[model samples]
Target chain A: MRSVQIPISDETIRSLEVGEPVALSGVMITGRDAAHKWMVDTFIKKTRQPEGDDQQVYAALKPILAGGVIYHCGPVVAGLDTKDYRFVAAGPTTSSREEPYQGDVMRHFNVKGVIGKGGMGPKTLAACQEAPGAYLHAIGGAASLIAQSVKRVLGVHKLDFGVPEAMWVIEVQDFPVVVTMDAHGRSQHAVIEAQSKSALEKLLAA
Target chain B: MQDLTEPILELVRLTSTDLPADVEQALRQAVEREAPGSAARGALETILKNVALSRANSTPICQDTGTPLFYVRHPAGWSTRSLRAQIESAVAQATAHAYLRPNSVDSLSGKNSGNNLGGHYFPTIHFEEVEGEALVIELMLKGGGCENVGAQYSLPHSQLGAGRDLAGVRKVVLDAVHQAQGQGCAPGILGVAIGGDRGSSYYASKEALLRKLDEPNPDESLAALEARLTQEANQLGIGPMGFGGETTVLDAKITHLNRLPASYFVSVSYMCWAYRRRKMVWKDGQVSYS
Candidate 1:
């Protein structure tokens, strides 16, 4: 198996090949359904006032504090400021939950990398191609131990949404993630499902 | 008969934020067993690790602190004043102590129930009358990601294409799981409830999930179906986290109702890797661990 560390960058993300297992290391932001909605409303859609100016947003259902990786996690977080704590349960909601808002967030935030348990839907791929960004699929249900690897939780924002669904800003190093969908419009999720179905048909015939 | 309001509430509190002793032990052992894939195995290890962190630091195991779902089977013919309130109070108490992240959000107003209370969507409790004098409660922290994958379908009675047979039901379930893909977090447990009306099917599915992983299905046909589904689903190669490989489903469970010629409804619920659920059986005057 080929393993390589890719730095978080807009152009690098645009060139990723399909089905390439990637280990991501770089600054990544955490945003989920609530946060995604917030970003769109506040920024692009302008339904809600802008929280901040242009930046890269990760479609993370949870966030981990480790060396320098952005986990696609939206953890159930409690507390505020430095005292924040995350539990290792199902904080990572479905990545599809943010399908409608991902493309907008990428454009508005200038996000280079996105980490989540599941890859995003079609709109996201279109956006990724137009922008400098990629969707990395991390193994789902690895929340608890993954939290332990979080070297340091840089800071947390948006406590108003409650911990389980809050938008967290965390930093990590050498975080494990696979490049499922890259900026060049390649998607591993679609490829694998097709392959798996065909393989199952063969097994059934055999 | 004693008023179980306070005690039941206490049990709810303890189970929600704290991993009961048996659950803790069981989880620790599961990690040691070490599921196949590095990621699946790693996920279980993290669960055990989180239990340690939670127990030591008194942090809630997961932030979802989900809707405190309780399955309580108490003595038959026993009735009390305001059972729901008592349970709610217990959830509130446990939520406070567990340091559970406030997850209950007011649907109409879209505001967080700051104390993890007040929301209609949380602390979902189901009650049943059983042959015992005491109350047995199974508390599950049902996170939204996993909960979203739950499916309830009404299949018209027939054979072949006429009705929902094994193949038809299998197709629905397979599609349900496949549609869920990585969203519900695979390598998960699927709770299937068949042969009931809409509401009963839903309840039956949830009840089926309470069965222990190793316990054999009571009905031979359903049990056989359960085993078959488990094998078939894993064969889908959904694997842990839906990445690929074997070990897609940890277990599959089925519970059914003896139905007439009416429509058959099948409901499926998905439990993600961190299946945080515990049981407490009441005994004597003192509340003890399960």
Candidate 2:
């Protein structure tokens, strides 16, 4: 197992190998479907004009993503009325859904990694290579356990997107994941998909 | 009629936080099947520990608590309107209590309801009047990852030489598992409905998932098909989260409906490893849960 703190250096991220276990700590931000779209449209694509605290949200996230990781999650939180937010269940959402925006987001922000479940497509793998980043695969549906690693909910952005779609900044310790795709262009997900496809064909023939 | 909001709230809480004994047991067995220090075993171990933590702390097992699916079998003369109101009430309360996330979102407006109530169809409720004086409600919290990977196949699919028969059903099901990979949340239980129209096909497929994990279809042919499909799917080696290990599917439950002569459809609904589902019964002024 390897230990990775937030704002991970490119050298450290590049050294990480696919199929290796990792424990991520320090501060990171959560972004899911809506957050990704909003980021691309308002900032990267410049298709949608910045409005309603969009600039402020970006300002908050800019430094965090410069070398830090973005987690694909929409966590269940408590104390919204009081604004003392606490993440109750915060597991990784399926990353493939964000494939359209993930690569662009990484390039725009110089992000070091994307943490999520399942995996992403070739575009994301290419982005990882360009930015010296990686794709860390968290266990899908292991929410309560994963939340235990979250020591604090620093803040949140995009409340109108609902609890699951909102981007949350949090402090974590020892968040577990497997390095499915690495900067060196190796991808465990691609390997597994190919192997499974071959196995399926053989079974059908039998 | 007695108000059922409280019992339903409890049902939502338990279902969200705890895994059914059968599902948990299968996960335990799956863990042992993986090689030591393998990602598959590590994933299952984390899942097992998460269930315990969620149960003890009464937190949601998954951040996406998912849409609530309710199957209601009540006696005649009971008001479905009132029952629905009560269910919605309990669902909102659960959200406030953090047992459920505010999952409902507007399709066009790009807005969230901020409660689980997006519309009438948001928390899907299927009601049937049975010949009994009791009321029974079954709830399943099907997560979005598995739901997104669900699939339906038309009969006489020429690619695999599949035709309108049980053989075709097996082919499509295996195809779905391979396509789903880890995205369907492996060690998944497949709920398959064959022979219904497109809409009912999908509906029945999801409804079939409410069955106990190990329960088999009553029909001899269907039971045998279920067994064969389960084994073959695991053979594809898409273990937990597609990490690749000994187990891919924990169980498969199959059910069929009469189809029009022109149509033969097979719908497969994938349930994630969390497998959050539970039942509540109201009988003779007494309430019990299982």
Candidate 3:
């Protein structure tokens, strides 16, 4: 198992291999379907056309996102109204749901890592290789266990997207995940899916 | 109705925090089956540890506290309206207490109710009029991850070469499991319905999940099919969290519905290892939970 800190460098990400378990520390940003779409459509695609507040939004995120990890999660938070928010249960949501927007989000934000489960498609694998990022697979249902790694709730963005879909910036320590898709262009998910499909065929034949 | 609130709240809390014994046993066996130091074993170990921590700390088993489904069996004169109101109230309390995450969202506006209530059919309750004087309620927390992977198939599928027979049902069911891969959190359970229209078939499939994990269908044929499918699904190497190991499916419960001659539908509902379900019985003005 590899223990790495956040704001991870591209060289560190590139050196990670598929199936290597990792303990990620430092700060990361949470974003799921709504946040991903908002990032891609509002800030990324309109990068050149700085209209309205798009440029400002892009500028605000640039520093935080450069070489940072985007976690696909919708954490159950406590004390939202009292200005004190505690993570009740925070686990990785299915990554494939954001497959279309992830590649673009990674490249546009210079994101060095994507933390999620269920993995992504060929496009994401290729994007990780090109962007030199990695896809970290967190245990899907281990919500409370995962929340233990979150040391602090930094800030939040896009509250209009609702609680689960909102972007929560959090500080974590020893956050456990597996490198399912690394910057080296290998994906354990793709390999497992292919092997499982062949096994299904054999079962049907029998 | 006021008296019913506490039991319902307790039911919600227990369902959210405690891993049912049947499910825990199945997971323990799966852990033993996997090779030492394997990824699948590691994932299952983490899940078991999570279960223990959640139970001890009284936290939600999964972040998605899911759509709370209530199956109620009441005496003829009992009011379902009052029961629904009480259940909703209990759900809100559970949310405030952090036993349940606020899950209901406005589909049109994307606004969370913040109390796990208010959306249409949220905390869905199904009532059945029975002869018994006791009120029995079963609650299941169906997470979004497993719910998204559920599939319904009409027989005579050309792609699968499935006909309107038992073989066809087997083919499509296995196909759904394969498609789910690790997305639904494998080492999961399958609740299958064979027959009924599109809507009822899906309903029956989820209802099938209410059965005990260790129990078998009373019908001999369905019971055998359940065993066979469970075995074959594990053989697919889709193991726990799709890490690859000896156990992919922990249990499969099958139920059949009478359908019109024109329709033959097979619906499958997948439940993750965190299968949160519990029962509460109200008898003689006293409530007891299991």
> Best candidate per TM-score, number?
2
Lowest summed lDDT across 10 adjacent residues in model 2 chain B is found at B209-218
Q: Give the per-residue lDDT of model 3 (tens digit) for A66-176.
A: 999999999888887785888889988999999999999889889999998888999999999999899999998899899999999988776667778888889999999
Tens-digit per-residue lDDT, B174-236, candidate 3: 999999999998889999999999999999999999899877799999999999999999888
Off by over 4 Å in 1: A1-7, A11-28, A47-72, A78-91, A151-156, A199-206, B1-61, B76-83, B119-121, B156-162
The lDDT ranking, best first, is 2, 3, 1
TM-score of 3: 0.97
Candidate 2 Cα outliers beyond 4 Å, as residue runs: none
Docking class for model 2 is: high
Residue by residue across B1-290, what tens digits does model 1's lDDT show?
Answer: 66666676556545545665544454455445444545446555545666666666555555555667878777766553356667766666555554455667777767777566784446676778888566677777776778887887667423223246766676566656766665676667788887877778877787787777778987898788888887787777766566565656667888878655767777888877556677777766767644
Per-residue error (Å), model 2, residue B61: 1.0
**Residue B282 displacement (Å), model 3:** 0.9
Best by lDDT: 2
TM-score, one value per model: 0.81, 0.99, 0.97
Q: Per-residue alpha-carbon lDDT of model 2 for A1-206, expressed as tens digits?
A: 78989889999999999999999999999999999999999999999999989999999999999999999998989999999999899999999999999999999999998999999999999999999899999988888889989999999888888888888999999999999999989988899899999998887676
